[model samples]
Target chain A: MTFGQAILEALESLNGNKMRSGLTVLGIVIGVAAVIAMLAVGNGAQATITGSISDIGTNLLFVFSGGMEGGPRGGPGGGRSGNNDRPLTLGDAEAIADPFAAPSVELVAPVIQGNGALTFSGENTTTSISGITPAYFTVRNMQVAEGEVINEEHILGRMSVVVLGPETAVNLFGHADGIVGETIRIEGQPFRVIGVLVEKGGGAFGSEDNAAYVPFTTAQARLIKRGALDEVDVIFVQAISAEAVPLAVEEISNVIRARHRTPIGYDDFTVFTQQDFLSTFETITGVLTIFLGGIAGISLLVGGIGIMNIMLVSVTERTREIGLRKALGARKRDILLQFLTESSLLSLIGGIIGIMFGWFIAFVVGQVAAATGNDFVPVVGVDAILLSTGFSAVIGLFFGIYPASRAANLEPVEALRYE
Target chain B: MDRVIEARGLTKTYKMGEIEVHALRGVSFEIERGEVLSIMGPSGSGKSTMMNTLGCLDRPTSGEYILDGESVAEMTDDQLASVRNRKVGFVFQSFNLLSRLTALGNVELPLRYAGIAEGRREKARAALEAVGLQDRMTHRPYELSGGQQQRVAVARALVNNPAIIMADEPTGNLDSKVGREIMNLLLNLNKELGTTLIIVTHDPNIAAQTQRVIRLRDGELDPENNETIVRKK
Candidate 1:
């Protein structure tokens, strides 16, 4: 018989026991629906998590000075920074600024921090004085919401200038409009505020808006006393091109090592690019998605097995029909195809309903989350739907085999005699 | 002068647990077209076995059975089903019409299997009309009388336009008057279609009506192979 004919026949035969057929197909529907919903949700969470991480700044790289490994694990003194005998000083920072070797290198800053109590009017608040270059604004993509950032001339001429963070300007000046060209006292010294950073809602917890930026020359010459402790805290390198960050990091590490004349395995620093940071978040979120999907997959497996069991029962129940079909010139392949088609159709129908339900559920969850002020959205994409639907079809095909074969192999006479 | 049924050294042995019971001995015979042949036997005489083997439902143990210049004894299962669909139609005693279908649908089944195109419904209606069931075209099997169900089966058998109509005790379940009516229907079909008809029964009275009668006793052919096909194993 033709495929259309066989399909119609199979469907017509189901009406013989309507209730049983409905109940049996219900299991497949539930299974396909669950598989689609869980997979879409899992995929949605992965996209949201990764997008949030990337928003922080994929171009930002982090390097810490007091890292372990080469410093702590070394038998003797190794790198200049970690050793008690050798310290990372201004000279080591200067060597990484060889512009001829790294033409794309834009700015390099040596960072030093000191905390002091500030007195402006009756308010005495303590805050960290961050020493950085004028180019630090460019490196960090900071938008100025005031008069202007300190220029490169100010750093060279040792001019005393300051920039207020968003929260600091709000707290110190109490101007709801804007804080610009304002003076705030720092450690019994008066400094002119030149700029204010645009307000950025703080990440996770602590507010980045509550900090302040001042040129390194001013901080070293006027505010903090230069004691015998002239140790540099860290080095920030900005590449001229974002694509050069990895090579820049590699070369910077090498230049620092050469400048320090460090021994093997005792370097007290870690150099990492933005991609490393991104991958760290990727690993974490990827694992989370797979774990959740694995749990959902268990249920899918149970559903497939359930279908196999029901198909087996159907083969036995329809033994006479199978015999009659065989007697009417149906090939073995025809019988197999008929049973397989039924299973796949059941799964396909179930998956479509499940996908629609899942998308709606995910959308509702995103709306509720945004309502709660999280500002996060759930994303369900075409790839997830295709993956889940394809998997459902594969599950049906694999599980539909045994019963189809059994039906195809029955002896006509014995089947005809079935009670 | 085409012999529609010819068997040479046909044998069929059935295994019943640890013992082998011979269903048909080495017997041979032939029957021509348009003839009504009957096989009459007592119980355990292997008449059903012979009927099954002839119907391509079971293969003979060791034999040469030829039908219309084709070797049915060596045909594949699908080939046998093809022969059944194209050349042999069956009418059983209990009326093996599919119960889920209406009368029209039941008659259309064989043609459906044969992949017949449009107008199957009209043709099935015509078949039902011929069976004297035109008004009952939409009735299911359960709603039909015992005799009507058998008539639907007859319509199903003729729908494919096969060469022969094979009936196994066609009136065994009916009363004498109803049985006679069924017999008349079969004779009418033969007269109209000129189909070779084979009937198997235990009744000698039914056997006497056939143009030729073959009898089996204890799985062996009776002294009747002179005119009828006697299949033995």
Candidate 2:
């Protein structure tokens, strides 16, 4: 018999018993749906993380003075440069920021960070107090939401002016709207909140919204009390462009090594760019997405088994019909193709429906994430859809062979005699 | 003198566990082209076994059968199936029409199997018309009466234009009036289309209407019984 005729016959048989056919294909539907949904969620999470990390700064590098001994490290640039014992100095920052010393370094800001209790109008809260130059805002992509950022005068004159992060302003002053110009006592010294920073959510490193910023000179003279006159914990460096980061890192490394007079192989410092952190995060999330996709594939396998089980039962039920077809001139291959076609059609239909359903589910998830203020976009790739549909079709064919052969091998006399 | 069916000492044995039941024992017969023949016997008389052997649905344990010039005994199952498709047709006692198919669909089955692609529907319609089932072509088996279902079976048997038609108790489940109508239809096909007809029945009255009758007792045709009867009417 022709394949078209056999397919028509199979479809008629399926149509005859709609409920059983629907139930049989339901397994495949669920299998494909789970696979697509898992991929969507995994990819969405990866996208969100990548976006937030990039939002921290553009073409920036973090230079730290401490050595992280061994094991796989985060991509080579941004983190806490050092502790107080072997801290970076203002002179080091000046040398790195000098255009002739490091041609690719566009800007550098010294950072001194400490945790302190801030009391504003009898409301006390513990928060991170950061020491930075006016250039810190430019290097770290910070913006003043309510008032001015730290000025050059504030840095050189050692003024007690501070800028509160959006969340910190709300916490210390009880309202972010009027927090600018308010006097918040830090470590028993009163500092005027000159500005409130704009809102930015959490990133891979941590949230910046809970920190309060002050001038590096004021922090050095009044609060930290470290013995060294020019000591700072970290330095943020911005490159002229993204392609210049590697060159900027190499130049800064050479300048710092000369300033410290450190030996070549035992340099006590690490320099990492934002690109490094991105590659590291990509590797981690890529492996996780595949692991999740693999787990979802197991359900597709179960779905294939369901198709096989139902196909076998159908062969048993249609024994006499097979005999009749055989007697009417159908070859063994004809019978085998008929059953195989039926199973593949089942899986194909199920896969199509599952894809649509999976997309709908993922769209809903994206909407919910948006409602909760997260930047998650559900991405359903074409490759994912094609791979899943193709895999399901193969599953149908693989699971269909035994049952089709069983039907094909039936003896005409025995099958005809089977009531 | 053209023999459509030639059997030489056909033997069939069934192995039931350790016991062997001889269903056919050295039975020889020759049926000429366009001949009307009947094989009648009681239960366990080897008549059904002989019909199965002649229809190419089975092979003899130790004998030879030549159907329409092909040596069926040595043919593989697939080869025999092809031979059956090209040269043999069958009508079952239970009107073995696929229940899900309409009368037209059932009738087109053999033509479809024969790979007659273009005019299958037209040929199926003609076959159904020949069997007086043209009015019921769109009805399913359950919708048709027992006699009408048998007529659909006959239409299916004729649609492929096979050389021989084997009817196994074709009227077994019908009333006497309907049974006679089925018999008349088969006889008319033999007369009008020059088709070979072989009817397997337990009713002597049905056997008496055919041109030649053969009887089987136990596993063999009894020669001493002189059971080959020629009907003059």
Candidate 3:
């Protein structure tokens, strides 16, 4: 029989039982929707993680002297560089900051660190102190929410000045504005709060909003009490131009290594630009999203197997029809193609509806999330929608073959005689 | 004789799990074009086997059978199907109208196999009208009476304009009055269209109405050893 006739007949059968067909289609819809929705959320979370890591700019670089690995106690002895103690120092940052020395380099900031009990009106809490030069604010995108930023005078005089991050200011001083120009004690030494930092939002590790900043030299002298010989904790540097970042980093690394006198492989310190952190974060989030979405895609397999099962039932139910068509001169491929087309159509219709429904659901979820807080929830987009719908179609086309071929290959006499 | 169907030394043996049963044995016959032939026999006379062989729905175990210079013995099943679909049309005892399709749709079935598109609806309407089922074209098989359903089946058979019409008890499931009506429709096609027709039936009255009757008993022709076969009225 003509393929058109066969297809029309199959469609009529599907149309005859509307509810049953709709319910069958519903299976595919749910499968595709779940896949899209899960992928959207995963992508959203991944963007957030990567955004937090490199929001400052890829041209910015950081050198943290001590992380999980602890460095030497007292410096300028026999360090990993054979000049001793922890590797980096303020001199290395000053060396790179020299304009005529490396014109491609822009700003550099020395950093030191200490942690102790911070007190405000007898409300004591443990707080970390980050000692930073004046350029640290611009390099890390930290703005002064109130009062003045740490200036050269604070560093030169070794003044007891401090900047409170938004979270710390609110917790101790009651009002973020109240914290500016107030005195707080860190390890029983009083430091004047000169500025409050802008809110930097949450990150994978912790809230960037929670911390205190002070002049590098004052912090080094008062709290840390380390001499010029102590290894530098960190140095923040920004490239002279965004385009020149890679070259600038390479030159800085060369200059730093020459100062420390260390071989490349066993260098005691790590230097990486913000872009490196961003890409690393992106890779991590991408993998996490795929893993989550892959688990959600299991439903498609279940739905596809369901189609195969129903098709097998249909073949048995219409064995007589198969026989009649065979007797009327239908080719095997005609029958096969007819059944396959029917299955694919079923999935396509289901997928279309599912994508719309999934988007609606994701929108609703975003609305609910927005109600709770101001966080923007990620949702289904073109790629997710197309991928899911196409996935459903592929599932149908892929799984629909066996039963269709079985129906097509039936012996006319055998099928005719089947009760 | 302008022989359109010729059977020589035809034998069909069926295997039912190691027990062989002879269904048609050494039966030989020839039918010329435009002949109205009826096969008359009781149940188990192997008449159904002969009908199946004639329809090319089953193959012979040992035979030399030819249709219009083409040997049926060597023809593949697909080739046989092509011959059946093109050269012959079938009307079943049960009216076999595919219960789902209307009268016109049923009549349009063979045309579908023939790949006759472009105004097939008009052709199917015309064929149904020729069977006197023009008013009943929209009625499904169940909606139509037995006589009407048989007429629809008859229209399906004629729509292809095949070389021969094979009806296996065309009125087997009908009442006596409706049976006569269906038989009259068959007879009219034979008379008016001069179409070759073969029918299998146990009714002597129906067999007597045909131009020729071939009696089968126990898988062979009755009272016969190389008997003369001829058209009679």
Candidate 4:
């Protein structure tokens, strides 16, 4: 028989038992939908994380006052390990800032952070306070939304003036705007509010809008003292361009190594570029995507088994019909093709519908994520769709082989006599 | 006479577990082209076995059997299928029409297996017309009466225009009136188309309508009951 005739026969048989065919197709539908939705969700999470990480200025390098003993650290104020490690000092930051010593370095902002409770009138909230210089805004991509930023005079005169991040401002005072001229007591010490930073969204290390900034000299002289008076916690180094990040890292590493009197490869500090963090996150998320897709593939396999089961039932039920066709001179290949076509057609139909259902699931997930103030959007790629549908079709054909062959190998006389 | 079938000492043996049952034992017969013949016997008389062998549905154990000038006894399964498609048509007692298809679709099945693509609908319609089922071409088996369903089967059998048509108790499911009508239809179609017809029946009245009758008492033909009827032209 021709392929067209086989298709027609398959369609008729499947139509004859609509309930059974529909139930069989539903198995594949759920399998494909799960695969697509799971994969899309995985991809979306990866995109959001990487997007936020890349948002943190790809040209910047972070230098911490510790050795590279543990795995790569995330954000600022990570753990410091090893007894041989020396604290990062303001002198090292100044040296790295010198254009002659580090040509690729555009700016360096030394930071000393401590947690302090700030009170405005009766309302009080505790948040991390960072001591930063004028270059901190440029290096960290921060902006002043109200009043003015800390100037050179504030650092030279050791003025007790502070800048609040948007979230911190909202917590201390009623709102971010018009809170510049207000005075807030930090650790029971009165400091005048100088400015409020613009709102920057959350990232890999949590929300950036939850801290307050003060002048570096004021913090070093009056607050946050660790080892030396000029000791700093971390230094934010800005490269001339994204391509110069490696050069900036090398120069900063050399300057710190020389200052700390450490041998090669045994430095007292660690320097990390944005690319390092990006690759680490990508590897983690890529594996997660595959793992989730693999789990969803199990359901697809179950769906294929469903197809096989239904096909077997159909073959047994139509034994007499098979005998009749054979008696009418139908070859073995014709019977095989007819049954295979039925199974494949069932799965193909299921695959198409599953794609739509999976897309809907992904869309709903994205909508829910956005509603909860999350910067996540599920991404359904064409490759995911194609992979699932093609895999389902192949699964149908593979599982159908046993039943179709069983039908084809039937003896005409015995099949006719089968009741 | 142009011979359409030649059976020389045809024998068929079956193994029912440890016991051997000889279904056909050295039965020999020759059928001329365009002749109407019948085989009549009671249960366990090897009448079904003879019909199966003559219809090319099964091979004899040890015999040289030829149908329409082709040796069919030693043909492979696929080759036998081809031979059945090209040379033999069958009308079953239960009217083995596909319930899902209409009369025309059932009639077109043989031509489809024969790989004839073009004019299939016309050829099927013509065969239905020949069987007086032209008006019932679009009716499914469930929608037609028993006689009409048998007529559709007859149309399907004749559509391929094979060398022989084998009817195994064609009128067994119908009442006497309907059975007589079906017998007359088969005999008339044989005379009109000059196609060799073989009917296996237990009814002597049905067998008497044919030009020749072969009677079997056991696995072998009974010569005493075997008779040829000469019909007045």
Candidate 5:
């Protein structure tokens, strides 16, 4: 018989038992849908993380005053022992900023951070406060929505002026606008809000919108007096270009090592470029994506087995029908093709429906994530769709072999006699 | 007379789990074109085995059997299937119609297996009309009476215009009235189409309708009642 005739016969048989066929299709549907949805969610999470990391600023390097020997350091000022005692100071930031010493380093911002309770109009909230120079605004890609950012004049004069992040401004005065000139108390010290930073989304570190920025000299004199007088917590460095980052890192590392009087191998500092963080995160998220897809694939396998089970039952149930067909001069290949066509059609239909179902699941997940203030959008790539459909089809064919062969190998006389 | 089937020293041995059961032993017969024959024997008398071998459903262990000028005993499985498609048509006692198919679809099965794609529907329709089932072409088997279903089976057996038609207890499942109707339909088709007909049955009345009756005792032919009724042509 022709392939077309076999397909038609298969369709007729399947249509004759709609409930059984539907249930069998549903198994594959769940399997393919789970695979697609899981992969999309995993991909979306990876994209969100990497996108936020890239948003931190291009061609930038972070310099922390600690070696890599210690196990898993927390954010700055969580306290570390041993080689971490040597702190990065304002002098080191200035040295790295010098063009003659580090030509690839375009800018540097040394920062000292602390937590403080801010009160304005009887509304109180505790937030992180960072003492930063004017260069910090440029190096960290911070933009001002009103007034002006901390300038060299404010740093030299030790002015009690602060810049509020958009979220912080909203928390204090209930709005971001018209509050730039208002005065807010930080740890009972009255400081004028000279500027408000524009809304930048949350990042790998945390939401920059929830913090406050002050002049470096003011922070050193009024708050954060525990560390050495000129000690800074972290230094943000901007390279001339993305390609210049490695050279910039080398220059900064040499300058810091000379100033700290440490040898190359035993330097008490760690400098990392954005690429380093990106590669590390990519590896982690790639594994996570595979892990999720793998788990979903197990369900797909189970779906294939379900198809096999149903096909076997169908073969047995239609033993006499098979015998009749053989008696009607259907070749073994014809019977095999007929049953195989039925199973593959079942899986293919399930695969198409699963794709739509999976896409819907991913869309719902994205919507929910967005509602929770996350920038995650589930990514349903074409590769995922193709992989799932192709795999399911193969699964159907693989699982169908035994049953189809069983139907094909049946003796005409025996099958016809099988009441 | 043109010979349609020529069997010599036909033997069929079946192994029932290491116990050799010879279902057919040196049974031989010849059937001419347009001949009507009946195979009648009690249970365990090799009647079923003879029918199966004659229908080309099973190969003989030792014999030379030819059907419609093709040597069938030495043919491969696929070759035998091809021969069966083109040379032999079958009607079973249970109606053997696919429950899901309409009468027309059932009639078209043999033509489909014969690889006759184009004009299959027209041929099937003509066959159904010949069997007086033109009005029931769109009805499924369950919707038809036993006599009507058997007529549809006869139509299916005639669709491909095969060399021979084999009916195994074709009226076993029907009442006397329906059985007689089915028997008349088969005999009339043989008379009109000149197609060879072989019916395997235990009913003597059914055998009496045929031109010849071949009876078996155990695995061999029973010489007592074996006779060919000469038809006045």
Candidate 6:
């Protein structure tokens, strides 16, 4: 018989036991759906991390005072600056930005950050306040949605004009728009809002929107003046290009070491590039995705075995049919093809349904994340879809062979006598 | 008349755990094209084994068989299948219609196996009509009467126009009246289409209707009759 005719016969036989077929395919459906959903979650997290890191400026490195030990000091809400441990200063930032010192270094923005309660119109909210140079906006890709960004004049003159992050603008001024010229009190010091930053959403460093920006000179002279320590919390450095990151990191480390007169292996500072974090993140999520896929694959394997079990039962049940077909001139290959086709069709149908269900799961997850203020968008990779589908088909093929061969190898005379 | 089947000293033995059960022993027969014949025996007399050997379902342990001038003993399993498809048809006592397929679909089985693509449905319909089962074309086997199911089986046997039609106890499960009707149908096919019909049964009455009858006793030809074989004009 033609392969098409065998397939039609297979389908007809499967249709004869509709409930059994449905139950048999359920295992595959759950397995494939879990795989797809897991992949979606993994890819979505990777995309979100990549996007957030890119938002922090490409080819960038962060140099913070204090050693890599005991966690990151002078970080956000990190009280107690490393004043005794060779703290990074504004002078060091300038020296690193000098082309003669580090040619791979492109731009450096020194920042002194602290938390403050800003009061406006009798309403107050706690936010991180950072003193930065005019180059901070360009280096970090920060944009002003309204009014103008801090200029060199504001930095040199130690002006009190400030840029509010969108969230800060909305929190203090009750709205984000038309707040460019609003006056707000930072720790009882009056400051004029010059611009509101465009929203960039929440990420690894928490909401950038809840923060505020000011001129470095003003923050140094007036706000939280620590005498003689003259320390900046962190210095953001940009490399000339992505390829220059490692070179820039090495050069910056060398410059800081020489300038600090620190000995080898006893360095008091840590420099990390965005690439390092990206790769680390990728490894973590890649392993996680594989681990999840493996777990789901176990279920898929079980599903395949279930198919084999059912197929074996079916072959046994249809022994007489096999004999009858042989009597009707069906070759061994014909019987084998018919059973194989039936199993594959079962898996293919399950894969299709699982794909749709997985997509639905991802959509619901995305909606839930958004509802929880994460703004996370789940991405369903086409590779994941194709891989799972191809895997299931292979599973069906691999598992279907034994039973089909058993059916093919039946003795026609004995089989015809089977009750 | 062309010899549709030629066998010489066909022997088949079964070993039931160190005990040799000889199913057939030096049984030989030649059937002509378009001949109507019956193989008659009681249970355990090896008539079924003879039928299996004649149908090419099982190869003889030590003998030769030539079906339509092709060496059945030397052929591979695949070639045997091809020979079966091209030259042999089988009807079982159970009617052997696929329970899942409609009467028309069951009738189309041999043509499908023969890979006759065009005019398959029409030929199947005509075969069913020939068996007076044309109106039950879409009925499944379970929905049909035993007699109708048997007719469908007969139509399936004829659909590919095979050279030899082998029926094993064709009316063993049918009532006397339906069995007679089936016998008349087989006789009519032999007379009108010149199809070779071989029925294996224990019933002497059924064997009497055929032009030639061979009775087997304990894996050997019956010695009671002086006539080892019979021929008819």
Best model number under DockQ: 5
Best by lDDT: 5
Docking level of model 2: medium
The RMSD of every model to the true structure, in order and in angstroms, is 5.3, 2.9, 3.6, 2.2, 2.1, 3.5
Model 4, A1-419: lDDT tens digits are 78898889889888988999999999999999999999999999999989988888999898887677754442234555666666788899999999999999998999888888999899999999899999999888888998899989999999999999999999978788998778899888899998999988886667779998999998877767666667888899999999999988988888888888987667767898888889989999999999999999999999999999999998999999998888889888888898999999999989999999999999999999999988899999999999999999999899999999999989888887788
Task: Report the C-alpha lDDT of model 2 over B111-229, residue by residue, as the tens digit.
Answer: 77777899888999999999987789899999999999999999899888888999999989999999999999999999999999999998988988888988888888766654568
B17-60: candidate 1 lDDT, tens digit per residue: 99998888876878788788898788888788878777777788
* CA lDDT of each prediction against the hidden true structure: 0.72, 0.87, 0.78, 0.89, 0.90, 0.86
> What TM-score describes the B chain of model 2?
0.97
- lDDT of model 2, residue A307: 95
For model 1, chain A alone compared with the true chain A gives a TM-score of 0.77
lDDT of 2 by residue, A194-280 (tens): 998888888676779999899999998998765468877788999999899999989998998888876657556667789888888
C-alpha TM-score for every candidate: 0.81, 0.93, 0.90, 0.95, 0.95, 0.89
| Candidate with more favorable, higher lDDT: 1 or 4 | 4
Residue A34 displacement in candidate 3 (angstroms): 2.6
In order, what DockQ does each candidate have? Answer: 0.43, 0.70, 0.48, 0.75, 0.80, 0.69
- What tens digits encode model 6's per-residue C-alpha lDDT throughout B1-233? 68988889988999899999998888888888989999888889898888887788889899999887888887777777778888888888999888889999988887887789899999999999999987899999999999999999999988888888999999999999999999999999989999899999888788888888888888888889523446573
Q: Which residue runs does candidate 4 get wrong by more than 4 Å?
A: A74-78, B227-233
* TM-score of chain A considered alone, across all candidate predictions: 0.77, 0.93, 0.90, 0.96, 0.95, 0.88
Please write out the lDDT profile of model 5 over residues A248-360, one tens digit for every residue: 98999999999988754876778888888888899999999999999999999999999999999999999999998888899999899998999999999889999999999
How many angstroms is residue B127 displaced in model 5 relative to the true structure, after the best TM-score fit?
Answer: 1.4
True contacts kept of each: 0.44, 0.67, 0.40, 0.63, 0.79, 0.77
Number of colliding residue pairs in each model: 7, 5, 3, 0, 0, 0
Q: Give lDDT for model 3.
A: 0.78
